[model samples]
Target: MNKKSCLNCGHTISDEFCPHCGQKSDTARITVHSLIKNDILGSIWHVEAKFLHTLKNIVFRPGKTGMDYIAGKRIRYNNFISLLLVLFGFNVLSYHYYEKFAPAQPLTDDVIYVKDFFSKYSKIILFVIIPMLAINAYSLFRRIKLNIAEHFIIGTVSLLGILILFLLSDIVSLIGLWKPVEKIFNIIDKIIFGLSILFPAITYWTAFKNSYSKPGLLWRVSVLYVLMGIETLIITAVLYEIF
Candidate 1:
């Protein structure tokens, strides 16, 4: 048993926490040794637990994670900004891989391949992602009441899933599975491509149940469909220009 004192009023306390002043009775006189060891260790442990939990939840179940954060069950996860930074970095890298190596055209034997790849794919990635993310943001803004960052994370995770699917296809293509199942995967890919546009919309629906007074789901779906169509047109134009 450790004897402690309240920092305020100089009252002796039996436990680690002070009942009189409501401060930690274990707080010792500020010293270089204790400051570096005890304070830093405690803070680091608290932060580490939250960060790991957040990463785990985000990776395994993104929709639920967004719902949890929006419902004020935070402190079990990392804050939005930290997750965004990490996600953005990985997203950039993933973008490079998808645009470079996974397309119909191989990167080698053509200097123009890199430039053309970016020219064609960049706009699709941008326009589609932006509007979808916008819908996601507004949905959460109206419904579960999370900040912009949270909805963006939901969108990002969904897009990341699509990207992963594409990469998996690319790998299978290289491993001879593409030849055997090329036709089948192509059909599947087309379906996935269409559904990818609806990811953020679904995420919006799941995260925000009935917290907001707004238009019906049909209205929201219709609006998102129109935005997706516009994005599809923009991407088509960009591809045409590049090719």
Candidate 2:
């Protein structure tokens, strides 16, 4: 390997990462631009950057991306959890702004309450359920050679895909929040609703398929699909009973 000096502790190094201080050998020098751009403003999150590059792969070839990641071919991709948390922060900010423009309505019935609850908090709920979802997936696909943490990686990526869909739908909703296209936005919202549910299962299916192509992969994924449906209904039922 080519040699370099560790910037933090002045140790000699021969790899991208320093073995002594564990810092990147090429850590950017601190400047006002670097400080705000790289760290806070996320200037590196552009489409041509590693984050969007990873997203492009995740959108098109999710399963293969997950497989390659777990197989240790991950030098090019950004951290999945970090990317998700960043996006979730955007999600929260967008909703908070949109909520300011909308009016409050009293919860008249259980159906309305559940629908409103999910309308505001579905992505957050889905994020909370990811660990449980990972457990469900691993239990169903026990034949695959993955531990819970590895299963969590797959689940996180799948949820990332769904979160993107939700944000897109919410953007449409936000536009309709002020515009006069109430009817059209209603249709679009319905479409977004369908896509949000379907895309996650599709993401999980493709990811699992690409990672391992064994017999019964189809049925295992199908079982997971059915379980997710049951889980959603159970949640709705529980919410109905509680509120």
Candidate 3:
């Protein structure tokens, strides 16, 4: 085989990849086959691997995952912002379909308007809300000494977990069994809502405990829950006023 120059940096190379710039040496002419196989399919698989790895860590070891990512061990996980965007897409799609296909309940104009507004602006709302939560977290846990950006990363992971629960709740609500038994459906809805809130609290507590080596686990967890509640209330009030 002839030694070829690196297309990226013009360095001479004999191996399959450029040592200087790390670009693949086999940069052949582009074709439809190569585009589909290497670019589209390969990228999908790579993203899927990173996403699932990050999700597993977020689900089982959220604090350690957040700490690792903040500490610069990020090759194994998807970026926090990327994950948040994916979650937002999933949330919007799931809720939109749920509202469209599920049996309609008679809602007042104000209630319908609020729901529509939230559905349209959920991502914008989250963009604002997550930073506020991050600020509260940083303030409450200043003893740990992490900066606001690190806290924001932690907040994003916590929100990702909540988004998963929210998707699950939407799935459960779409089940056909709910139509016949109004009482049962309402009860299940309340339960799912409660679990959505509780799971995120647990997620945040675990992540905080792992990320920060603080002494007061119980106290920290309690205070964190309080902060979350306050944040939720404030967000709800703001949304209500806006819509």
Candidate 4:
């Protein structure tokens, strides 16, 4: 029955929260006690829970999650960059362990080379790979009616799913440090690596299977592979020139 402006967005409020921005209607001045109780205790838990929820959604149902985000169900989810940063941190830690605890027999030179290359250029490679794959998917899947930006989200989510599979494979490979388990882990690693290779195509097919007739979908996926190959070549050439 009383009118007040929301401190966050300066929107007029009549109830407990400002509907415009969802900030609490009764804004209070920051104090040490409030900071500890409300922000440190409350906000941290809220943020942590939200991040886990978002990660679960992204990992379990990337396509549906992407669609829901674009459709405005965004309050509970972190954006692509936030989750990517978390993944990047995970990669950094994994690489550190892989280096500090070197495998007993040492990996092949090709594997070492691949690891070094990605370690040095992962940030740059990520910027290129995610967007390029997104563009390719957007181009082929335009029938879904998502704008380029929306498709960008879908593309990145799909790629993020692929990244998770590879990261798990790499983590699994780490167990190979134990010689007795090394051979078995290596076999498991190869299987996971094989799955990672096909994950993108398989995920795309599954997402679009009902969106288009089988032949139509297959043709689009085929072109997507060609475009992805060309994109990879272009990125490699550019990165080679630079570093």
Which numbered prediction scores highest in TM-score against the true structure? 4
Instruction: Give per-residue lDDT, candidate 3, residue 3.
Output: 92
lDDT of 1 by residue, 1-243 (tens): 766567776787888667777777666578988887778986898877777676656545667777776667876776665555555555556556655655465456466765676655764665367446656456535655555665666666555544444444444443433467767767776665555555555655555546534476556656766766776678767776667
Per-residue error for 109 in candidate 2, Å, reads: 5.0
Identify the leading candidate in terms of lDDT.
4
Cα error, residue 32 of model 4, in Å, equals 9.6
Candidate 3 global TM-score? 0.75
Ranking by TM-score: 4, 3, 2, 1
Each candidate structure's TM-score, on Cα atoms with residue i matched to residue i, is 0.49, 0.71, 0.75, 0.79
Q: What is the C-alpha local distance difference test score of each model?
A: 0.61, 0.75, 0.77, 0.77
lDDT of 4: 0.77
Write the residue-wise lDDT of candidate 2 on 1-243 in tens digits.
678788789999998888998987878778998788867677555534887788778767766777788899988888998889877877777777767777786666976866777776566467756786788888987767689988888878777777776677777778887658867987988887797676656666776664556556766777777887788778766765655
User: Compared with the true structure, what per-residue lDDT tens digits does model 4 show for residues 79-179?
Assistant: 77678778777767876787678745668998887667767887787667667767888878888877778867776776666667667776876788778
Please report how far candidate 2 places residue 21 from its true position, in Å. 3.7
Sorting all predicted structures by lDDT, with the top scorer first, yields 4, 3, 2, 1
Regions of candidate 2 where Cα sits further than 4 Å from its true position: 1-7, 14-19, 22-48, 102-112, 115-124, 177-189, 210-215, 235-243
Residue pairs with backbone overlap in model 1 = none
**Collision count for each candidate, in order:** 0, 1, 1, 0
Report the C-alpha lDDT of model 3 over 83-188, residue by residue, as the tens digit.
7888878877888888798776899998888777776666766677578767877877777788999988887877777776677677777763456875676677
